[model samples]
Target chain A: MIQKEYEKNEKTVTVSVVNFNPVWGDKAANLQKIKTMVISASQEGSNIIAFPELALSGYECGDEARRDHKPCSMHEEAAETIPGSSTAEVAKLTKELGVYVLFGIPERDEKNPKVRYISVAVIGPEGILGSYRKIHLAPPPTFTEEACFKPGNDLPVFETKYGRIGVQICADFWVYPELSRILCLKGARLIINCAACMVGQTGPEFIAQITGCRGTENFIYAASASLAGKERTLSYYGRSTIAGRAFPSFKQIFAQGGDREEIVSATLSLEKGQPPFDQLSLEKERIRSFELCANELKKLAESR
Target chain B: MIQKEYEKNEKTVTVSVVNFNPVWGDKAANLQKIKTMVISASQEGSNIIAFPELALSGYECGDEARRDHKPCSMHEEAAETIPGSSTAEVAKLTKELGVYVLFGIPERDEKNPKVRYISVAVIGPEGILGSYRKIHLAPPPTFTEEACFKPGNDLPVFETKYGRIGVQICADFWVYPELSRILCLKGARLIINCAACMVGQTGPEFIAQITGCRGTENFIYAASASLAGKERTLSYYGRSTIAGRAFPSFKQIFAQGGDREEIVSATLSLEKGQPPFDQLSLEKERIRSFELCANELKKLAESR
Candidate 1:
């Protein structure tokens, strides 16, 4: 794993985004790859490290015809519980390294064996914090997330020693701006997106643009870790990025990985003057719009 | 005026975005400039033409100190009614040329002369169409819109011969994604943003990025026209753009303008196969999320 760092100062938090390809349906190999990266990142002094969406089980789960013909699909077989074996192993590593880790996995419902969710598991030193299921599933015609997985209902923000962090899956971050806004209102200083962004879906540049806007609009740090390389018919382009307010004013890409396998890191100062956490003034200013937006939203809902 | 056009077919609508510096608070000169551009654009076969926000009186309304000291500030003095002399003249031009025009001006409230709005007036061949008032006012610390103008409460979609069009001012377009989504839900085929986007507020590239996202997310044509050159302490970068889905799939920038004074035009195919008007399938797909988004928004509002 290659390591790079931004200039660090007092009251700073360093984040690392891992961009790698997972062997399709190979949980053991993927878990080992993730552990190695976690250890390396922890040794490099990263407070938080994030892996791409569906990194544990890979993205594709066989063709539609085959899945329909078979009694149990590859995704169903690979799906595990939130605090299942994979997360338990990662939690132990996080506990030993004293660093937080976030990665996506197929989550099997505890009550119903048939139900599954495309979720990102947040593992901290204390153990598994929680998982944020994919809220906005990729729609039909081109993408097929909605066919296999059920959409998530809640938007949860996890508390960490470094700061409050909110997680979003690929479509949740790319398609819906409301999710990020709600997360920001709930006091999330950082928004992390775990994505299995494919080349055919949208341009890599457009993804970075949306990621940067999420940060600029909320005045918070936004990071996206995406899967790379080809698997089955899909080709994932891993242009992972961490975007937020740079020193004085303008929002920019703090650190970015390439379209190939790589790890990008950036050290951000959370002090008052150093932005993405200018909470007091900016939030007060934005509060005026919240009521207006909420009222409009309510009206739209009532009409619908 | 430099004119450039994308290849047009049988069912296509051409749009022109004007990037020009208004003579600060000079109604006569600004109106004359607008008329000249409209006539030029109409001759170039543009079905619709849009100008920057506060194009009549310019963006800055003196300074905070001057505004506090004077009984009638420059903005108040310059404010006019929706169907006032400016729109009347523009309507005459549009009627003569057979085209639709959208441009910003200081709108004086019918009942209270002291109350003003940063609004975009829509004028067509028939006469004066209604104006859309700036909903989300730019807050303090930097912007002075809230201090001088009353926020508009409604989101109106105007029906035109070409399509249904929605208008948004600078802060409304940049800050709130909800407004655009609501407009899209209300059956707006195109969203036009009139902005006096200053350099210090955000990068020009960032503005284009957000503009593209607005189009890509909603699956509709999104266009932005902004003021060019300097006005007192503020330096406005034009960079107006028209973004939407290209031929088969990808969302891309169809047309764009530069930092200096210029006029950009694009001929967009609005046919069934051609996108930004793929209305049937895309709209049906997005309806599922609308109810969910609306419900979440209501919850947020109630909590607030």
Candidate 2:
């Protein structure tokens, strides 16, 4: 496959994304299709390339996913190891194209003996940067994705050539605010959210507000890659989007087409902007106020 | 006192406010001071006249704030019932001026075997509409005023001659989002914060943003009554302000007077503006995106 060579390097932050309309359960064909898209991303000069969650073998595995499920989750069987063929494919392209990539996969946990994790692989210039698992599992309405995937406990922030990087799997951004807070505090100028949201749920507006509020509250940049388009069993909404604090530097989006997938690109500036000190100070006032209110009423005794 | 004869037949939202510079220990002078302010608020056509916290006796009561130490905390100390003395004073004015008045005092909570509450009284045209205790307290380093006050827990949102009315003490606005959220959710279109904030202690920018964000998030108006001039023992910063999504109200105020304990007023239209909801939505987006990095980031994201 002919990979795209990055076109610009003028201190510009660029985004490369691939939108795959894969045939579910066919890992072999999906990999072949992804190879062409990954190459195109490299040729187009994407500094950071991202793919949808569970893109390796497609999103709906059902019983197959169950069989592959680790002791606790379907995600256990999602991916084999860091050096698995999927990693090799992306690593080869990343090394050759000289760019960063964020992809989703299922894997077994090395610790705790039997738990498997649904994590996003963040491959950087040096090697696999790290992985962030879904913290807030989408229980009820979404039907047992958590039954197969073990939840991630620690929040990890990494230093990369671009900036301090923070990553999280799908649904993590929706329920928990602490993860976002931790990332911002760690100086993650940019946080990437790789999600697989189904059709007919709280659409783009809900996603935008959730991500936007978190970014505004913490003063950090947030980018997201969502699954798009539909194939049997699952319909991925194709509007994959990127967001953050810097302009003309971090926006890139993608859509899907027939039989295979397509890659999209954009530019992002990773420079630091407003520090979060002011906002943090602002929140401290609330806590102080809480104490004051309680104390005065106590002195008032029965007043409380 | 020629109390303002406000028209209940008319649809007007009048906000009553009291400006106080506490002596921290003086009650007699503070009481007299509120008497004059309440009379003035009533005479001047304020439908809802309010006062700073503990205006009846200065907020700095320390250990002497308890009912056992002071008769003011006892209703049998019998200032007035609904038409008691303080209530009588406000009622006479509201009835004379045809307006409503809300003022703060040390309330003897008669319900729970003699609890004293630092409360604000809402005196309507007919009688005492209701009372709200300082639910949130101000504790130490919180300055000279922290050690004595007890916090109130139940937040009561009342419906008056105007739209819906939600009354809260000073620091209450800073901590919980639930109070304002409930008010708006309950159809209270306007939120009035009765407070006494210190200079340099409270960041104006943060307050404005919080107010604006709250308004936009809940779709309503926000008004705050902060002490205008420094009273004995306190340096009052008089920049009481009003904010809402229904108007194009923008003002550039760098430094305001540290003196002048007068009622500074503004007319806020609860009526809808000419702009469509979508236009307003976009306008809101633009204003929120004012921070250069966020705006640029949003632009880039959308452009891509």
Segments of candidate 2 deviating more than 4 angstroms: A1-11, A17-20, A61-77, A111-114, A246-265, A272-304, B1-304
Q: Against the true structure, what is model 2's DockQ?
A: 0.04
The candidate 2 chain B region of ten consecutive residues with least summed lDDT is B248-257
TM-score of candidate 2 to 2 decimals: 0.49
Top candidate when judged by DockQ against the true structure = 1
In order, the TM-score of chain B in each prediction is 0.90, 0.70
Per-prediction fnat: 0.23, 0.01
Put down candidate 2 lDDT per residue, A81-173, tens digits, no spaces: 655667777777778777788877765566543565667777766777767776555442234455566666667777666667688665555
Error of 2 at B152 (Å): 14
For model 1, residues B3-34, the per-residue Cα lDDT tens digits are: 01111223578989888788887888889999
TM-score of each: 0.90, 0.49
Worst 10 residues of 1 chain B by lDDT: B1-10
How many Å off is the CA of A62 in candidate 2?
0.9
Provide i-RMS per model in Å: 3.9, 15.4
Candidate 1 regions off by >4 Å?
Answer: A1-10, A65-72, A273-304, B1-10, B64-72, B247-249, B274-304
